[model samples]
Target: MTVDIEPSRAIPAHSWRRWVGLTGLLLAEAMNLLDATITTVAAPVIRADVHGSASSLQWIAATYTLPFAIALIPGGRLGDIHGRRRILLISLAGFLASSTVCAVAPSMAVLLPARAVQGVCAGLLIPQTIGLIKAMFDGAALGRALSLIGPVMGLTAVAGPVLGGVLTSADIAGLSWRVVFLANLPLGLAVLGSIRFLPEDRADRKPSIDVSGALIATAVAAALLVPAIDATIPPWARLALVAVGLIGAAGLAVHMRKTRARGRDPIVEPSLFRDRGFPAALLSSVLYFAVSTGLVFVVVLYVQEGLGASVLVASLTVLPFSLGLAVASLLAGQVLLARTGPKLMLVGVGLLGLGCAGGVVAANLAPAANLAPVPSLSPWLPVSLGLAGIGGGLVTVPFFTAALARVRPHETGSAAGLLNSVQQLGGTAGVAGLGAVYLHHTGTPGGALAIVFGTCLAIALVLAVSATAMLSSPKDVGQP
Candidate 1:
C-alpha cells in the first residue's frame, strides 16, 4: 500500500521557525548547486594564475566531485541518525571555513584540498536540505516545498558563470578567482542563522558510521574514476585500476551483506533496491548524466578556446543552458502534476538529444587553425545547450520525486543517501569515461568536444529509451 503524507491539521504557532528552516534548506541547496558550476567559469582564470598542471586542473573539478560522491551516503546516514538540523548547522559552518581557505590558497595543492573539504561540507548540507523538507513538511505542503527548490537551483546555474566572470574581471580586494569561493561565506552564514532559529529533526538513537562499508564504497569509486582518468597511462595501470575498482565494489557488497545479517544499519542498505523501479531510474540517470556533464565540460572548453571569448563573454554565451533549465523546470512540475509527466519527459529528452547533436555540428564547423573564431557558429551554441537545459529541468525533480515515491516512509533518509550517491557517481563517471573518449580522439581546440558530445548523444538516446520504457507504459511505472 502507498503512504501519502498529509500536512498538519492545525497551523503551528512556530510558523516562523518553520520558515527559518526552509530558508536554511534553500541556502544549503544553493551552495551545492553553485559549487557544481562556479568552477566551470573560474577554471580559465585559475589556470592562468597558477600555471597549473593538467592533473591539477582536473583535480580542481574532481576533488569537489569525488568527496561529494563518497561522502553523500555517510552524510545522509548521519543526518538520519543524529539530528539533520544539527548536521546542517555543522556543515554550514564547515563550508564557511573551507570557502575562506579556498580564497587564500597560494598553490594548486592547497586549493584542491580545500575544495575537497568544501565538497564534504556540501555533501552534509545538500541531502539534509531535502531530508529536512521531508521531516518538516508533508503531503501537499511537501509537494509545494519540493517544487520550490528547482527554480532556486536553476537561478544558481545562471549566476555561477556570470558571477565567476564578474569576479575574475573586477579583481576587487585583489581577489581575482578567489571571489568564486569567497562568495559562499556570507550565504553560508545566513543559512547558519536560519538553522539556529529553525525546527529540527533527530533520531533518538543515533547510529554509528559503517566504516567498513564507507571504505569499500570510497575505494570502488576512486578506483573506477582514477583508471578512466589515466586510461592512456600504461596497460598495466589500466588493468590494475579496473581490477581494484571491481574488488572495491565486491568488498562493499560483501560488507553490506554482513551488515544486514548483523541487524544493524549499513551506509547503503540493499533493501532500498527491492522496489525494482529505483535501480532502473538510477540506471537511466547514470546514462543521462554521461551526456549532460560531459557536454557542459567540453562545451565550455570549446567556447573559450575556439571563440577567443573573454571569461565574462564565454560565461554569458553559455547562459542559454541555465536559462532553459530554469524555464523548463518551472513549467514541467505543473505539467507533471496532471499525469502528463511522461510526455514532458519524452519532449525534454528529445530536445536534449537534439542539443547534443548540435554540439557535433558546432565541433565539425569550428574554424580550422584560423586566426579568427567563426562568428556564425557562436550564436547558435547557446541555443543548442539551452535545449538540454529545458530537458534537464523537466527530468530532475520528477525523477527524484518518482524515485523517492518507491521507498517506504521510514526509509526516506536511506533512499536519499543512496540516490545522491548514485547521482554523483554518474557525474564523476561521465567526466572520466566520456572525457577519456574525448582526449583519445582529438587534440584540436574543439576536437575533444566533438567526440565527447557524440558520446553524449549516444548516452542520451539510451536514457530516452529507458525513460520511455519505464514511464510510457503503465505496466513498468506501477505505482511509483
Candidate 2:
C-alpha cells in the first residue's frame, strides 16, 4: 500500500534533519546494491574455496534474488501497517546480521540460507526508502531527493564490482572472498546510526496481510525457478514442477479475485490487468532484465573461467559496461526521456540486441585469447558490453515512467511494487535459465558464451518489439 503522507506529517521543508535522514536511506540502498553486484565478482573464488558444484554456484545467486522478489509486495504492506521507520530499522538490522552469517559461512549449505535471509531483509527495507522520503519532503525538495536516487544507483553500479575485486584480491586478513560480505558491516552500522533522524509514520488505517496469497506466489516462483536452475533434477520431475507452477498461477488468479470481492486488497491488484498495456510492459520488463542480467553473469564467468583472468581483471573487464550505462542513464533521465518517451526505450533495446550480436562474434573470435589485462581482452567484447550498458540505461528510467503513465492513483503503489518485484524475478530467471545453458556447455567455454549471447540477442529483439506497448499508453496526466 502507498502511504500518502499528509503534508502536516512531513518534516519541515527547510530542516537539516531531513537531509541527514535521506543520507541514511541512500546508504541503506547502497548496501543492497553492493551486496547484489559484489557477489558475482566473488562467486568463482567462493566456489573454488568451498569446493562447490556448478549448481551450488547458481543457487548462491538465485537464492537471494528469488526470495527478495517474492518478499517485496508483502514488505511494502508491512511498512504501511507498521511504522515505516520501525520496519526499516528492524529490517536493516536483520540485513546486517545475515551479511555477517554469509561472511563466515563455511560452505554453500550455510551460505545459501544466509543469502536468502539477506534478500528478505533487503526486500523489507528497500520499499521503505521511497515511502520515508515521501514523508520527509515535498514539492521541489521531493523532486531533488528523488533525483539523487538515479545517480547514487549509477555510482554504486560502477563501484560495487571494483570494490569487490579489491577486497577479494587484497585477501584482507586472509578473508579472501569473504571480505565482500564482511565489508557490509561498517557501512550498515553507519546507516543504522543515522536512522534516528527519520520521523515515524504509518498508515492511518492498517492493511491486512494476505498470508495465503504470499505463499502461493512464492510457490509459483520457486516451482518455475527450481526446474530451470537445477540440472540434477530428472526430466519427469522438471516437467512436474512446471505443471505445478502453471497450476499455482491459476490458483493465484482465483484467490486474488476472492480477496478483492471481500473488499480487501490482494497481494497484486487484479484491476491493473484490465489494461492491455500493463501486461505488455511487464513482459517487456521481464525479457529486458533477463537478457541484461543474464549476460552479466555469463560475461563474468567467461572471462574468469574461460580466459583464466584474475578476479580483479574480470571485474575491471566489466567496468566499461557499467560506465557506459552510468553516462547513458544520466542523459536519458534529464534530457531524452521527456522528448522521445517510449521510442527512446525501443532504441535502447535495439542497441542491446546489437551488443549481444557483437558478443557472439567476440566470443567466437577470441575464445582462447589471454585476457589477463583489461586492454588485452577482445575489443569487440568491451564495445559490445558498453553498447549493451547504454541500451540498459536508456530503457531503465523510461520503462517505469511509461509503464505507470496510465495507472490509476490508487493502483500506483501496487503497480510500482510489482514492477520492482518482477525486475528482481527476471534477474533470478536469467541466472537460472541462461546460467543453466552456459553450465551445460562449460567444456566449450567459447561456444557457451556464443550461445548465451545469441540467446540474449533473441530475447532483446522480442523485448524491443513488445515494448511498443508503451507507445499505446496515454501520456501521464500528471506530467507537465
Please provide, for model 2 over 1-480, each residue's C-alpha lDDT reduced to its tens digit, 9 standing for 90 to 100.
Answer: 777777777888889999999999999988886676778778889999988888876788888988888888999899998889999999998999999999999998899999999999999988899999989988898899988987887788778777888899899998999989988899999898888899898877778888999999999999999998889999999999999999999999999999999999899999888777888888988898788777887788888887888888878878877888888999998899889866798889888888899999987876565655543566899899999899988988788878888888888888998998998888888988898899888456778889999999999978976798656755553233
Error of 2 at 294 (Å): 1.1
Best by TM-score: 2
TM per candidate: 0.89, 0.96
Tell me the deviation in Å of residue 49 in model 1.
Answer: 1.3
Candidate 2 wrong stretches, greater than 4 Å: 369-376, 473-480
lDDT of 1 by residue, 1-480 (tens): 012223442225446666677877797898876886678767767866878754444567677877887777788667766667788888888888988998988888788899889888888778677767766776687788887887787688677766777777678788889888888888877777777655466544566678788878887878778877654468788788889888877788778878988987777767666656666677777777666665665555566655566666667767788788877777776665466744566677888888888877777766544334433454456777888788887777577766666566656766667767677678767766765665466577666667776778888888887776546333433343
User: Model 2 residue 432 lDDT?
Assistant: 82
The local lDDT score (0 to 100) that residue 164 gets in candidate 1 is: 76
Looking at model 2, report the run of 10 residues with the lowest lDDT sum: 471-480
Candidate 2 to truth, TM? 0.96
